[model samples]
Target chain A: MITLRQLQCFAAVAECLHFRRAAERINISQPALSAQISQLEESLGVLLLERTRRRVLLTPIGRDLAERANDILKSVSDLEEFAHGARTPLSGTLRLGVLRTLGPYLLPHFLPEMRRRHPDLKLYLREDPDDRLLDELTSGQLDLILMASAPRNDDHLTVVPLFREPLWAVLPLGHRLAAKDSLAQADLAGESLILLEFGDGLREPVLALCHAAGSREHADFRATSLDSLRQMVATGLGATCLPALYVDAEALADEQIVVRPFDAPAPARSIDLVWRRTSARSPEFRLFAELVASHLPTVVTPL
Target chain B: MITLRQLQCFAAVAECLHFRRAAERINISQPALSAQISQLEESLGVLLLERTRRRVLLTPIGRDLAERANDILKSVSDLEEFAHGARTPLSGTLRLGVLRTLGPYLLPHFLPEMRRRHPDLKLYLREDPDDRLLDELTSGQLDLILMASAPRNDDHLTVVPLFREPLWAVLPLGHRLAAKDSLAQADLAGESLILLEFGDGLREPVLALCHAAGSREHADFRATSLDSLRQMVATGLGATCLPALYVDAEALADEQIVVRPFDAPAPARSIDLVWRRTSARSPEFRLFAELVASHLPTVVTPL
Candidate 1:
């Protein structure tokens, strides 16, 4: 029988494609790691890795087995987490994935609250783009994900709405619409807008808003972060839409950029806490979601 | 002839795994996109996608082909960029990949300078982890990458040293060493340090620093961003190391956190501008690198 340790060693080697590096990654001696790999190969009656003087490459079957091994390891990890969750509510480590746009702004407030309330709970955070966050969450690498737009109609996952964050329009200080107390979509007609690139969850909503307002995305420019968008706006490239939480945390103090609210019925996006439905920690996650809702700043409406 | 359009359609389908969504992503009708996929499959004599009423899946061969198609598309993009670069330096869209830890702090200062110097240049930025940045740079999806500790002895790439950034020690306001004028490696012995999780370029250096100082990493917690690290330190989780640019930009004003420089021969990392050696824009990138070095604040020493 192939032990979990064997699979773990193979997975590490498959990922790094270097025996020495993989050995170091797992904190084992190179010869010991090599022995495990050799034993596993002999048991399976197939060669897994082709070793040259300077390079290591996986066989086709090896690649397929490595993926299966990762899945098995993830399942084992989930089982361990389940056992741990049975004994404690929020005391142990919880791997949380958060969106890049939200992590910087929300975590500063949320983490402190978590530290204050659950001192024993140790959170391991990973900030990534929305799709990658979702991928990691589904793969069991992350216990929970906090994102603006939750996945729709996925039976394997549970999403809890945490808040509704308004979208604010950001413009250069000397722009024509900057003097308005509150701007409507119509006011943006024919204006150029700078937006984040595709794959960002915020981009689609901003594109929809631009389409409704007759504004065009600056054909040649797409910012990678909220800071870049603000900088572009500051440099008079074009206006852009930012979430209320981000505006409050990062943009309100920028003298060159003017942030304005929308007219009645402001545009907003739902913030959610998502986890696997099969997770044993569902109850604790739901409770933690409430804590998150309570700790959010007043700029966003908690659900 | 198998057209680029067919490959684009197939790549989109492979990425989204849903025909309707893929078609929408590429801004084409579903039937039109399907026809393109069919044409490509017929020409190649292989089944690329297995489409059912509820889901779209890729065959094993489809997965391999999709990756190759992407590489071809990237090469085409590079050719177009080469032509554009030859026409006018820094006038067209330049896809730049930057490190997540650096972009937020540095771009606010850098973008405005770029705008002032080259009004026609449209910069498309993607801020990701170091590995992803390097992957994109080598894959031709990005014109350049700004990162620290660039890869060594890679003949396929060009590395331009930009600056050296000092690392600072961050502690909670009332911590034992908070009142000290400056800190040294000896002062950090036996301290519990919170560091960013692995895959971040900064983590390894901080871990080495911890090793040299006899400090140990906080095993139970790992932060995802510099902000999270700051928050963790603010809440007295433990001390952490932060780059000088980040300290100058974000952490200087936090009353609860004390940012102190290291004693003589402070720990530091090298920041470099990296791109593929085959890129036709090498001259332009070198000039842009110089501009970046010049715009960086006094907190970091430009190489």
Candidate 2:
């Protein structure tokens, strides 16, 4: 007996926490929204909202139902989207989640080609840590993701290897390491290394490389982003490691930051395009992945 | 620039993958649904669906946009839900994601009290692995969670320690060790142990206990759930260890499985109620946690 319209009204009112504002959001008169809420409550045999002079509140039942209603409405919306997609494979908006380390350097090179190929395609981009991006990907909040070191073992995911980019030692312009033509792992011995926070996918391996080189991590500081890490190095904070793509795209522009590659046995992270295995857009995603992989080496040399 | 109505219509159509079925899903006449799709495509300046005499398909762009539109609509719905909830606090539905290992043996005992105290509160429950549950907790997909080994170090999470539960060794009723009134760590030496698959929070500690006892995990048979492990022991399979609460509530019901406590220095897993620190429903969660803790020991003896 419940209707989407009633759920919409309830969601609107609950979100606005104001009957008038909710009514405005849904493009309905305030009394009309109130009537819908009453009808929903009556049908469910539970009170969903408690209206005071100053605020509108959701009862416990209201909260539960609102959560379920939101899921249902979203599912319904997803269904329609899937239907439309089946009819026109390359013409709508694409929501992409990319790694903070990879997106800035990677997307600019390939997205223009993607736009050229599918003139009607619109891209919505988000950049975050791999853990957060993968979480949203699994939850259907993100359509596809570009990430590093995807767990190939996860049966629920499909991963397309895009490129493997080496790690570069980022040093202040005039540092001893920067002046060297090339450096071996032993050359970094006793060096102070600063790195990104733990969850970024870039951190663990970078830490491992530093430890292997007999370098110690800076005890007091961990940068939140690659830009910040570069800034720290530029200001003579400490030397650090970054992916080659990032150094090429952003760090090279900074005269104070010098990027140098490891002499041999260089460490690199594999970047991949990953998505839900069950997604209806699998073919399209695969095609997009291939396009990106083919063009990647032109902008950032592949491993 | 996309409106909720257009997105909703698009989602419905995408789901059914058939124009008539999609229109029926939204309770609209097929022609009207078609008109709305046309209008949406016109506004977006792109063709969203491909129509043939017999079927409908999505352009690549259509698929991308549909996914993005779905997320936007869901966000809008969530915003509405949040606003309403701020006014009422705890009276709305509570979505609780609980660990598969703990929920069954724990919730039934205290849920009656939860119902009695806040009859208006509706609990929507999901049981998943700890990693998945924690991810959902952070992403706003779940309201609260009951899990083991709360990562107290995470500043974004607020954890309420409920109780500590001990692990019990389970064996067949007529086994030699089952005759003993109590068991010690050394008693399990040279014994064959069966365990749950890796990733369940219980696996690591159980493996450590086995190693301490000089026992090796059974290589071929890994039980998927506590009930399966109990059944294996009942049928004269290898012995296993389980939480005290699980042994009390579920394993004891089987006539052939015997549950025993350790002599001393028992290994235990701490159980806690966790939610996002920024959750507006913090006060309500705290009160609910208190109520559950008060009723806990009656059903599951605390360590």
Please list the Cα RMSD from the true structure of every candidate, rounded to 1 decimal place. 31.0, 29.0
Error of 1 at B192 (Å): 0.6
lDDT of 1: 0.81
Question: In model 2, how large is the Cα lDDT of residue A104?
Answer: 84
The digit string of per-residue lDDT tens for model 2 on B1-303 reads: 334677778888876778899988889899988988888887666666656445666654666677777776676566455544534435556889988888898898899988887776778899998899999887667879999887999987899988878888899878889989879988999888889886567988888998898988988899999889888888888898999888888877777888888876876678889987766567888998888888875424453
How far residue B45's Cα lies from its native spot in candidate 1, in Å, is: 35
lDDT (CA) per prediction: 0.81, 0.78
| 10 residues in a row with least lDDT, candidate 2 chain A | A82-91
Tens digit per residue, CA lDDT, model 1, B113-171: 88988887778899988889888776556778989899879987899999888999999
Candidate 2 — what's its lDDT?
0.78
User: On residues A218-250, what C-alpha lDDT tens digit does candidate 2 reach at each position?
Assistant: 888899999999999999988999988888788
What TM-score, computed on C-alpha atoms, does each candidate reach?
0.38, 0.40
